[model samples]
Target: MSDHAPESGPRRRLRLRTLLLALPLAGLLLSLLLVLPLRWLAPVTSAFMIAVRLDDEAGRWPEYRWVPYEAISAQLALAVLAGEDQRFAEHHGFDTVEIERALSAADQGSKLRGASTISQQVAKNLFLWSGRSYVRKALEAWFTLLIEACWSKRRILEMHLNLAQYGPRTFGAEAAAQRFFGKPAWDLDAGEAARLAAVLPNPRLYRVEAPNATVRTRERHIRTQMRNLGGTGFLDRLSE
Candidate 1:
């Protein structure tokens, strides 16, 4: 009996080691799969679009559109960078400073805000489901690292521009532009672009035509940020 117990303990320890080793290996394999040119697989963006539709039908809500990267107005990109993640181009995956700031703010009884960089957003959109949980956040971090390791900044930005929710049922800049003004995204003027970017923080509540006073206020703030960033020039940098 003593001999059998010792043998089983070694076996159990070995099993635990193997399982621990396999976990990251599996994750690596999955990450590789995500980055590979698997055109047949349903893209993360498309899946989210479907989810949005289902939510709307079920009386839950999601705002989204499918705008191409090229079709989107430059100001839209700039405004988002200015408002959401100024260090987007520079950061690899995470923004520790912003994370600390957000944590401190939350601790002070302020609104709990996200410190997700553009790369993080792209990863979340492409791979993970939307929710605020420790597990979800951990997965988001893992996927963000994978995406940054696998995809270029240009590709990440492209995916984000196309899939980000702009309004109720408006998923991308092109879709939002068409839905709101009957204009294509590329033709949107500076003010129009700024207004569209303003609603991104909470598109469901912010309408283009009859935006609440708060929306109007946010638009003005975004425009100011855009101007400070040199407007169109900052947007042009996204391409380079």
Candidate 2:
């Protein structure tokens, strides 16, 4: 009986170790097979469905459409770059300057500006559940590094454009273009592009056509930024 007890305890310990090792392996496998493919998954467009699940009441997930790095409108890309990440093409996964600035602002009790890069946003939107916790942030960083290491800058931007939240039941530039202007993505002009970029900060609060006074102000500012950045030419350089 004493010998059996010793053997049973050792076996239980070994089983626990095996289970712990298997857990991460399973997660890796699931990521490769399931989460990675989300880049190509059709956008979920049912407002009722999304409202039932997510806390955000105004954003919609659009069908997945992969716009080639070249086919995407340069003006639209430029607007996004100027509005979202001015140093997108140059930075790696993380932007330290922006991070430091945001941290300082947070400490000062000002607006809590997030320093999440497009890649980080992509990682969170595509793979992670939304939360404002240190654990979630660490995971976001890990996935952002993995994505940057595995994918090109162009690919990351392309994915972000296609998967990002636009409006309630609207996702992607193409979907938004069609919904807002009854036009294809390629047809969006600089003004239209700027409006889209403006709403990106908070799409639910801003309408494309009849935007509130604040949204109108933001759109105007984005347009001014776009002009200062040399418009489409800046986006052309992103590929370089």
Candidate 3:
């Protein structure tokens, strides 16, 4: 019983409510701080690469060599767009059509296929861990929005090319090019680019070094999609 009165219940509740309300805004501001600089500065490493390095199951160091967008071949970029997200240039960050289709499939008692857009994948690979948890998905969504708002479509795809896993040990187009094709990423032709993009679904299982029947089929499909997308001209949309 000092002169000061004890804290009132209503005031304590109001304080708690205010703190809870401010938390998400604070988190968003912090995320903006993290993503805005990446528009100009290329990431040195990604969360996925770090996870791979720390993984006990992964015996060796991952192969990741950063290459600027110019250093990577346009063929490879087009191939990735063809294989991963066909509507990449059209969408902002999320692909509503793909998500709706996936949800419809699940409602029909079919398996839910992955519907992540390139922007979402860039967010996940660059910033988050692998999981289906609501928290992870929420964070991914937040980062996806931040990235789309902060970086250009070109920067998003550039990050994807550098961060995506191409092989068990390979972590970028440059590494995949040097390891599999024995050439620099800049020299990769369409066929080579398509092959590399084909194994992206499950890189650890699908070998780019030795194309399985599935890999070959996907490679052919990607090449067809590339042609359907009007060849490398589709990539020009990234700048706009």
**Each prediction's whole-model lDDT (CA):** 0.74, 0.73, 0.92
Model 3 TM-score, 2 decimals: 0.94
Candidate 1 clashes between residue pairs 3 or more apart in a chain or in different chains: 64-170, 64-171, 65-170, 65-171, 65-172
- Candidate 3 residue-wise lDDT, 1-240, digit = tens: 699898999999999999999998898888888899999897888898888888847466689999999999999999999999988888889999999999999999999999999899999999999979999999999899888888888999999999899997689999999999999999999999999999998998999989999999999999999999999988888862
**Which residue pairs collide, candidate 3?**
none
The weakest ten consecutive residues by lDDT in model 1 span: 36-45
Better of 2 and 3 by lDDT: 3
User: By the TM-score metric, which is better: model 2 or model 3?
Assistant: 3
**What RMSD does model 2 have?**
4.0
How many residue pairs of model 3 clash at the backbone? 0
* Model 2 agreement with the true structure over 1-240: per-residue lDDT tens digits: 465435587888999999999999986776566445544554343232344246545444334344554665777887888888888888888999999999899899989888888888887776676669998898778778777766667777877777676676577888778888888788888888888878877776777777888877877888888889876777655542
Q: Model 3, stretches more than 4 Å misplaced?
A: 1-3, 56-60
Output the lDDT of residue 145, model 3. 86
Q: 1-240 in candidate 1: lDDT tens per residue? A: 465445587888999999999999998897788765522232545556667767775755444455456677776777778777777777888998999999999999999888889878777766677778999899888878877776666667767777777777777777777888898878888788778877777766887777888888888888888888887677555433
Candidate 3: residue 156 lDDT (0-100): 91
Best by TM-score: 3
Determine the backbone clash count of candidate 2: 4
